[model samples]
Target: MMCLKTMMVCSLRQQILPILGLLLIIECIISLKLLELRVPSHVPLGTRAELSCSWQLGEHDVLYSVKWYKDGREFFRHVPRDLEPRRKFPLPGVDVETFDTSGGNVTLSPAVLETGGRYRCEVSGERPLFPTVSDHADMLVVVLPDHGPMISGFRSRYRTGDRVQVNCTSGRSRPATQLAWYINGEPAPASAVQSAIDKKTEDLETTSMALDFVVQETDFKKNGLKIKCLATLAPVYWRSNEESALKEKAISNQLLRSSLEDVKVTRADRVLANSAEFTNSWRHVVLLLCSMPNLFLRGLVWFPFFLQEI
Candidate 1:
């Protein structure tokens, strides 16, 4: 009886070990996982954009379907078992060009401004296991400006105590560009910055800002006074325009006149000193000539010419 019991125990142990090994293998081989979800954070409007979703399936698992959703609404579907593996549903602002099954990549031609939103990619395994994995990311469709900010209402020059008022305008965009003012590389004072104005044209927007301040003597630097307008669209576009201003001509002319007066005064003083010296030398010569009688008469011939010159 003891020998029979030992054989039965060995048989049970052999069966249990094989069952446990098979379970471990099944667990290891059956899995559906999301590897990567590629969505652009910013896409330029009216341009093509490609989004990719990659996944991994274990040896025993089979890919059932891959679905893409925009703002929680299904837009694209791919099922390997179907006669047509790829299908696209109509969704506003989502223009599906092609869906590549080999790598599960989706392409959108001429993405519009309304295409900006949260996107999700979901992957599922074939029946029996039915494992699912998903991931999501946000995308923005941006309308970039064709050019930098433009400055207007600028004067040829500004002087101390003069009021300066100017406007900065940005190119048309989907979302209006934000504008800021800088004076001499520093942020303009809040008191000097006016409110931003927005203009809309057929779904595109343009923004402008005004800057007003009184010119001060301290505003001028070695490079002259600089006024800059900065335009930005968050996380994507940044541009600026700058203008330089000099002191008014009146002030410059006054300084130039003062310099000229100083030069004139110096020249007059030098001339007077030279004339006094020449007169004294001539008087000494006249006295010496008077001492010599014969030379005195000859000196008189040149005296009239010399007096005329004097």
Candidate 2:
């Protein structure tokens, strides 16, 4: 009886060991995998963006559901058991469309500047056996400017006492560009600048700034004064425009020479007498000669080219 009982116990142990091994094998084989989630390295504002997710599972394993999240908010879902395989939740400022729920792909048409952030994708299988698997990827949306900011209202000519008006205008920008002016390689005073929203289209806006100041004689000398307009969209984009003041010193000198020639000596004998007697006429001539340096005409040269900023 003892021998028979020992043999029965061995048989039961063998059966239990095989069943446990089979269960382990089945558990190893049933797996839901989230292989990868793809997002663009750079996505410009007001342009299209594509996001994809790849998953794998065993032949017998079923894909119960898939989900997409942005910054912790679930915006897309796919359930194979439901009649509608794909569904999208409205996320303000994010224009999202799911192209394929089974394939795990979506598109964002004309992405907004504020829509860039962390993204996550999740895949689920049979709940009690195969659990949910998830993967994450970061998408840093880049907001690119529509075009370079432009500098306008700077003329090619100006008198010394004239008020110089320079305008900086930016193309359609989402956050409304910031503009600043620099004169003679220095930032222009705030009192001399006036900014406004020049134009708008839908959600985008254009920014403009006008700088007004009196032209000074020093602005025309040597290398010619430089005026610059700077536009900023924070860390995303920085653009600028540079202009040079046009100096016509030779023309002014020619005009002075012509004036001197036109002032003919109506009374040669009287001019000689005044010259010999050290009269006020001689002092007037000396004063006129001293004032020649201050008569320079300072103007501006408009550049046709616009530079790119990254």
Expressed as tens digits, the lDDT of each residue in 253-305 for candidate 2 is 88888777667654676788878788777888888877774453221122222
Scored by lDDT, model 1 comes in at 0.87
RMSD of 2: 22.4
Q: What are the lDDT scores of the predictions, listed in order? A: 0.87, 0.75
Which predicted model would earn the best TM-score? 1
Lowest lDDT 10-residue stretch of candidate 2: 297-306
The residue ranges of model 2 lying beyond 4 angstroms of the native Cα positions read: 1-43, 46-68, 75-145, 218-223, 250-310
TM-scores of all predicted structures: 0.64, 0.44
Q: Pick the candidate with the highest lDDT.
A: 1
